[model samples]
Target: MRFRDGQWLVAEGVRIEYAEEVYRITPTPSGKGISLLCPTRKVMSRGDTLNLGTLSIDIEAAFDGVISVETTHWQGAIRRGPDFDLFPAGRPDVDAKITKTEAGTTVSAGGLSATVSGKPHEFDVSFHPTAGGKPLTTLLNRSVGLAYTPAPSSPMQLADTRIFKHYLFTQTTLSVGESIHGLGERFGPFNKVGQKVDLWNSDGGTSSDQAYKNISFWMSSRGYGVFIDTPERVELEIGSERCCRVQTSVEGQRLRWYLIYGPTPRDVLRRYSVLTGAPGRVPSWSFGLWLSTSFTTSYDEETVNTFLSGMKARDIPVEVFHFDCFWLKAFQWCDFEFDKDMFPDPQGQITRLKADGVVKKVCVWTNPYLGQASPVFAEAAAKGYLLKRKNGDVFQWDLWQTGMGIVDFTNPAACAWFVSCLERLFDTGVDCIKTDFGERIPSEDVQWFDSSVDPKRMHNYYTFVYNKLVYETLQKRYGTDEAVLFARSATAGSQRFPLTWGGDCESTPEAMAESLRGGLSLGLSGFAFWSVDIGGFEGYPPPWIYKRWVAFGLLCSHSRLHGSNSYRVPWTVDDDDQSDEGCSATLRKWTHLKARLMPYLFSQAQACVGAGLPLSLRAMCIEFPDDPTAWSLDRQFMLGDSLLVAPVFEEDGTVQFYLPEGSWTNFFTHEVKNGPGWFTETHKFGTLPLYVRPNTLLVLGKEGEKRTVYDYASDVEVRSYYAREGASAILVDNQGNKLGKLEVKNGEVVGSEVLTGEFRITVVNA
Candidate 1:
């Protein structure tokens, strides 16, 4: 929402109200809290009766630590976005005082104060005078007040009649050097400084600027994060509408925002996650590779067995096998019944797979869509649990499937019905669900059973309900910390559902790199666990591409091999000629390596579960804020706080990476290098640059392992790299059930076995 036409004027028909001078200050009690009401006038009023004509703005604490500012005169309209109020919760250790000095009247909160001009009408807010002290990043002029108007009749047209009214807005006065980031799951660029972003979820691919998950929380280069806490649609003009200021406005009257004071970007996310919920810890097995029967790819018992047997023959240890949408009969998804054509005996097949040392966790794909052919469709339609059009008919579309009506998650009865259907699937030996196609919800002419929410707001939030239902159902069946979903779409607070993957990407090197960018961006936006399709999702990737992707995917928090038209099995892509080794060889090498690395990977995952941090960390997120070299690098990522993973994106095996201020050791080759600088190196196809920071202890699982949930403490090989004098490292089990502590003093490994397990320690120098 932009509102400016020029430097000094608001757009035509735009009403402006200014609170120039404070006429009167009175303290009043409302309910349980005390509020301060300050009436401001455009002109000075010497008499008390004249003050009655002025408008009053009420300020009070909404929560224990949050302050709410409301208008007394124009309080009819509902407020929307870009509202910042400074109110600290709990008991303040610092002082708060309103003092009138020669310069102005200042209100201070925790050593931070805003100076209101003493002059009659010239008022502005400024931060501390010194550079090293408290930083005040945002301020509102006297022109700030309640704004209300009609919504835009047209969405696509930029210049609608509503632009002149309250709907379309333009604002200016942004700082020149300010940079912006975090509009959840954005693919174009990691930094969103000058972008015109629309806060709407879509099924756009990695090449375009559009995003699957859109969040209105962004951290500026000036050291503050602005979180627009609204589920509705929000349009943001970040240093775009006006070159100097960030202008954001929504369609409603009530606007609530939080200006998170972060001296650094990491602090901002830490505080933000505290406000919203933090990501939960998923089970260790989820960290291993997951093989899926690609969408639209023909597969039966024979095809499934071949892929499994080929992986085993290649020594690629696969933990979970997912069956795509075709698992159910055509046109009857959510039927939760496996297609007899694919597998005549689903139970017998699952038992056989489990007997082969493969824990059979089948991924049955389902959406909110209920086709007319589905048995539950008529029941939901009759029970008023499906979304309906304005004409009082159930909203049906022929997009993915014929006559598919979306399940109305807003209704409690509808969620129960949906969960019941999934519960039945779980009972029939089905392990997990690929909760797909949540981004295509219709906003217009749609009515939810819960009429309290706006239709447009529910569009993005629909994924939350859809994933939550399936996740909760699984948790109830399997217990907490064991539930997972290979979800596609998401919004704020959706990280509670453990695992989400990059949706529908093409089979190209460019798409592969973009997919990594999307996952990194999503990880930065507060999602802890994420994965992308190994090879690709749309077409058959070449053997070289597939083999390279296998290494990358296996390293992810969750790994899956999926595709659209062609099979993703290693044998299908490997060349038949003698010049190249079989696809089975490529799969065996990476899969076996992933299995061996499970102890180290799962240990890092346990830390992610304990702390609300990402397993796959972006460079800046883990490195020092003062390190200038780390700010721009995006191609590589730190696997956790300890190790840095630089995947080879090009055909040639050359890789470039930077190590921040420490002696680092290569995890694969055991080569040590002194860092705090950049390094470029070449490698073979089997190995990439994976380095561990100095004074670090890594627990490597035994060679040729099978499962992620093993005795991590037993037979664990602890490799201690560049351990300085008096330095120590600790390794804990998956549930934090066992502790393995090793200490290094004077360049010697002083190992102490804290718990019962088989372990070995390797000490290396930089």
Candidate 2:
């Protein structure tokens, strides 16, 4: 997308038009706004028709705002993509008319205005009325905007282009100290200033740069977020383009983006979530540790029993037990029928687990792919519910399953067929579905039921339909606040589906950290709840890695122990008889701690569901923006607004963490630390640094309430930490439905509300 050769000149065959002066400015008929007409050339002849050509320039506004500029030529045809802005119109608060004087033209919004100097084909758009604390005006430079002629013989590409096809681009100037962040579920470095990113959703594993969820939005260190309002592909050349600018371009003629003006990154996300709906509240038990049968692992009734017995013997409370893909007979995934060969008595097995005080929630793996052996495949194919080739044959591929054809979710009948299958699983004891694999959709030579829509766009959009169908099915079968999907892929608005997991990561510490980065990025993108394989998803994690990941995973919105080619039983992976020290003891320690902390963790999850906030919060999102230390720290994350969790990423359990501008109390050790600085410490496998922020009331559930779905407010203990003068804290129930509010004045707990739980307050001296 970068077109400039250097600072002085444009590349060959490029045309540049500079707006030298504003010829005229007139108020619209509505009197709400005014448009500035700038002529590119300077000439003085009476009645001379001025056609100075099109202007190539950059345009931007404060975050949570929008800017519109038009560049049209007589020759090129205007191509448009899917129409957006279907919801509502934004209102402009500040306005000033553009006035053209002999010197220049000036138009204003807010207290800010720009003046174009009167010169022949040379003008600079500079901020005007440089008085007071007016909002900054963005200058459009040469490299920031451009218009391109399409190649003469390239075939027309639409929604289904695998990656980006042809694109017209513009690069925005980047400041030397500026950094980029937030592109949704990216596994790369949290800061994206120097990266080349493509806005396409893929099923690529967690080890690679490819992401299952790709968002065309990014907030800059300069305090603004730019979100391209397109479902189609967008290419972002972040600092990669001209070294000083972030360049972005789409394929079509029309380009529209919203500049979300947040004085802080958290405010930007809050505004963005308001535009796109915020995440709904999930159930409390969804926060507890979930144990799953790893994909392709040899597991049956006896194997499941052994793992459950071992976990209990070790006192590791498992809330949900998941059965992966093999629960169904091979090649008949969507049938929703349990494999009688493996579980001769399905009901008995479920009943046994339920009786064991374990909430049995089977993780049934499914995709849009319907194998030929599937019972509903014939029905779907007969009703034209399958994606078809150009020649009208059902599109079939042998990727995961033989002769697998994707269910055409666009068709109402197809969605019904898919839902019917899930309803049957719900009818069986299956409480949840691990809705996997919407990433490898075929975009080329495919025909959707909605023929007018492009397939490339459908690739990501496909997950929307896929997840919605499953989620809606569960909601219809169960009820509201009960439907959740372990969805693997998503696009814009896909946050409507409650829970999604970081897909298929390798069993390594690097993969574990990468998964956290992806989840953090995804959280910023609008997804509220996320999970990762506790021991990673691919190979067996070493004991140290497993125990560390267990602590990290249990703190996430959802936690599941899953893997491939190996069983995830702690004893199997970390056996004392082997050379390495077993993580079985470590797992036993943290798992019980997580279970004990369930009262606090579930409350945090409820808060996320209610406020559309992320359960695992990045330090920058919660800390003061002026604290430079918060921006660079990503290895550790705040569990909620109160608790800071620094996960041990290394073998020796060393963690370097920062406390932002406060007196913090360590949750495990009753020690207090005054901060606004960095601290490096080492600990045994038994514990890590889990700190509570000053002036906070954290609720702890009563003992023996092993399940997360208990009446949290009934027997909750409120632990008050470091309540500074004039500070207050509130303890919410498992639903984020407020339970009690507490305040501190003169270093004492005050403003206590009626409490139904066994609550206590601890005020630490600063």
Candidate 3:
């Protein structure tokens, strides 16, 4: 954390010792082996043996182009732990080379270099553009420090003994113009320069700085990413403390971080996806609009039917129907059995719903919690499948429900028990699992099935194993491309599970903007696909808020309409517009608009999987990194490299956004604008600022398609907006099956690649 109060003085009781001298360096392999000694004080005489605060550091390479820097104070301290699922390169052949000279040693791979100094007395790693470059740019900047503060001076501890905690920290330098971003799905601000982020997942709502998903990976504008490899609590100050360095501290003797070198932000993301895992391809139909049964609201099969029928009556295409927690009885949550009172013929009703004119997928809510009243709770507890206290009792608490016990995902049999529960729902026509509530995992005196891992270490990491078990079950039953989870909590590699949503936002415009900020922050953190409750998640959204959010929701990678305690259906919550059918009509329009754009959106999803790009959804900086103005633009985002979507975030409908150096054409209107400047405009709830990039051919589905799951090539149209003479685009359908390539060459069109579908070209006046 922060040691100094402001700039000059250290806090009263805080004791800090920084690495003062580099003792020696023992060098080994090309990219793998190295060690250094960093003393807390200069070694002038042998009297220094009394208090040796010397830190031992091990530097090595992982995978192809990644570095692991581990610093330790007490080598034998017992607190080691649960790390994220990192995929290291299995000794691949590359151009990486490490050599030692008279002064020090150097390691170079691809276009990156890290230099280590021996005689210069520095335990730091200095990174630069080239091995011989004089302009020493960004590098890991801090000395390994040992910190101790007397455990709070309360009366409870005054009588017993003196106490202190051992902490270690490291800070990395930020270049002059560097802007720090990403630590997880944060809501406060996009540029994390002035933020103090804690990498601990919480159940806090989206309206605050507290995040449901807290990832330890942060990427900088200087084009490198750092991952703090700890599942326990980690605090980072991104320029808030020092105003220059990104300082990191964890509550243990050991400190480990992964330093990723990317010359570009995109390159850094690709490298990050390789280190963690890439997200799988979500099924084609999942790109459509989804509607959910609001939590704590009264609902059953009849309620679901009415919601679906209302959508059909208004011609709003809904692809997935979700059942929230009350789908099971109140206190019997996570029993994996549907409430028979509300849904007597669960399987039959689901079958009928799927048999409708529009194909629909069913998603049911699930958590790792087992209430004591649940029929399966005793079975799970008896089988040693629940988290236990140090005294061998099941760790039960009265939090969300009575005597709730967390499923011990560390045990294979426990996971198997959870998987069987999910399989029962899958047998009843359930297609996706809304994996919720993994942020409240216990870190106290608890025991795990795999006793080797400390419970403290599994606090944030518990979500990974929990989500993976359910996701693997989905992948096993359905194919790889068909599995999806609307997960709310995640770690670094949790992006491997597709489609996480922003959690518990209120029904207001500010909350909507906060969700956008969280989603963009998550994108920067390497989450592949993200969704938000269309009308916010907490209360009754105003009609205009719902309609405006509808445009933004439909255009995202995944869209859903959900709320906290009220129905999010258009007609039900439109109090201000009761005199008209405006909400229903607007929902119908935006819902079908997403269906028509399925050809373009699904192709982008395929690119996320096939290429290193995990989420085609991007922050503006990801696309326009060279533009200095784009790094700070968080309100607007590039929707899959082509369309720039700036969702109107206020009730007054006023909009102000930037277009970074492009010829942008309005998607709804044919108006074109020259960018590299700011624009202010006002519009009603029916529209938003969805601008298509210049010179790109939009591969679109046929107009008025009832469902989104059709063969994208059947009646596709490649529409061009201000087509440049040499600009071309590859056209693909919802399944990413190549239809053809459209090019404007030599002032004339040429070539045909479409095999079975009817293809046509239309030009829109820009």
Q: What digit string (tens of lDDT, one per residue) describes model 3 on residues 1-766?
A: 8877786776677767777766777764454557777788777677874555678777765645567778898787786557777763334344656778775676665556667764564555676654355323333324468777763445354244346676888877766888988888999988998889888899999977788889888888777788788888899888888887788898778999877777677888877877777766788888888899989899988888988988887778889999999889879988988899999999999999989854379999999999999888999899999999999999999999899999998888888778888888999999999999999888988988888897777998999988888898999999877898999999888888887999999888888889888988888888778999989888788788888888888877898889889999888877524333378877777778878877778777777665445353478888888888888987888878688989898778899999877688888887888888999878786778888888787877777775788877667777787777876666566656766766788755454455246767778843
lDDT of 2 by residue, 1-766 (tens): 5455676776554444344444555554444334445454544563443434433332333222333333322225434323332222243344444566776655444433455555544445544332334333344545333344332222243233353333445555576677777788899898887788888888789978798988777776666566677777778878775677777776654455555655577666666665555675566667777888889988899888888888877666777788888888899765667889998987788878888865545557777787888776887788998999999999998888888998888788878777777877776677878888888888899998877777777776777778878887877776777777888887766776778889989999999889988887887776778888888898878877888888788777677888988888787876642232356666666655666676677666665654556777454554456776666667888776788888889898898988888788888777888898888889777778888888776666665545556665566566777656666555566555666656667666665555565656554444
Give the residue spans of candidate 2 off by over 4 A. Answer: 1-139, 143-166, 576-582, 609-611, 703-705, 751-753
Q: What is the lDDT of residue 495 in candidate 3?
A: 86
Off by over 4 Å in 1: 5-74, 78-136, 140-178, 576-583, 725-728, 736-740, 745-751, 755-758
Stretch of 10 with least lDDT, candidate 1: 80-89
True-vs-predicted CA distance for residue 442, candidate 2, Å: 2.3
Determine the backbone clash count of candidate 2: 9
Score every model by TM-score.
Answer: 0.87, 0.87, 0.94
Q: Candidate 1, after superposition: displacement of residue 591 in Å? A: 2.8
lDDT minimum window of 10 residues, candidate 2: 80-89
Task: Summarize candidate 1's per-residue lDDT along 1-766 as a digit string, tens digits.
Answer: 5455566776554443444455444443443222222334444445633523233443332322223233344355433221211221223233444556777654444323444455554434443322246444434454344333332334343245345344322232345555566667777776665678888888887678777777667765555566666666778777665666676666544445545545666665665565555676677767777888888888898888888887776566777888888888889875677889888998788778878875546667888887789777798899988899888899998877788888998789988888888887777677777888788889899878876667878887778778888988988998787788888888877777878888878888778887877777777666788889888888778876776777677777788888889888776786432233455665566666666676667767766654546787454543555665565667778777677887777777677777888788887778877878788888665677888888787767766666666777677777778767766556667664436656776667665555345666766553
lDDT for 586 (candidate 2): 67
Ranking by lDDT: 3, 2, 1
As a TM-score, model 2 comes out at: 0.87
If both were scored by lDDT, which would come out higher, candidate 1 or candidate 3?
3
Global local distance difference test of model 2: 0.69
